[model samples]
Target: MIKHIVMWKLLDAAQAPRFKAELDSCKGLVPGMREFEVGIRTEGMEANHDVVLNSTFDDAAALEAYVVHPHHKKVSAYLGTLRESRAVLDYST
Candidate 1:
């Protein structure tokens, strides 16, 4: 299995609700995505990201399929306009 994680720094923390709605839209874009979850950070943790996503895929190829999927690309392009910075990670167990 592959665990894909993403941390997003939005233009404003207040914008997190909007971003979460958009993030949920990504679930239908990739057939291999086993699960998807998004979180908004409101605790004022100094080092916390504004938004985070957890996604699981069956394997590397399935995850790769999500990366190149057209719908995913479309959502990513929209995300660009709302983000200040982003980080990502993927690993298997």
Candidate 2:
């Protein structure tokens, strides 16, 4: 399995909800997608990024498919406008 995690610092922190909504739209978007979860920083919590995407794929191929999927491309394009910085981590487990 592959664990794919992404953290984003948004241009406006208050847009975290909007960011999460966009990420959520990609849930179950491709074959072999095991899990897809989006999180926003809790109020008053210690955090550097405003939103996160925690996902699991059956394998590297599935992860790659998710990356190139059209719906994902659309969401990503929109999110690109809303983010100031992005960080990603992918590992096999």
Collision pairs in model 2: none
Give TM per candidate: 0.88, 0.98
RMSD of candidate 2 to the truth, in angstroms, is 0.5
RMSD list, candidates in order = 1.5, 0.5
lDDT tens per residue, model 2, 38-92: 9999988899999999999999999999999999999999999999999999999
Any idea how many clashes model 1 has? 0
- The lDDT of each candidate is 0.87, 0.96
Q: Report the backbone clash tally of model 2.
A: 0
Candidate 2 runs further than 4 Å off: none
Model 2 per-residue lDDT at 18 = 86
- Model 2: per-residue Cα lDDT at residue 86: 99
lDDT of 1 at 6: 96
Q: For residues 47-91, what per-residue lDDT tens digits would candidate 1 score against the true structure? A: 567989999998999899988988788878898799999999999
Residue-level lDDT for 2 in candidate 2: 100
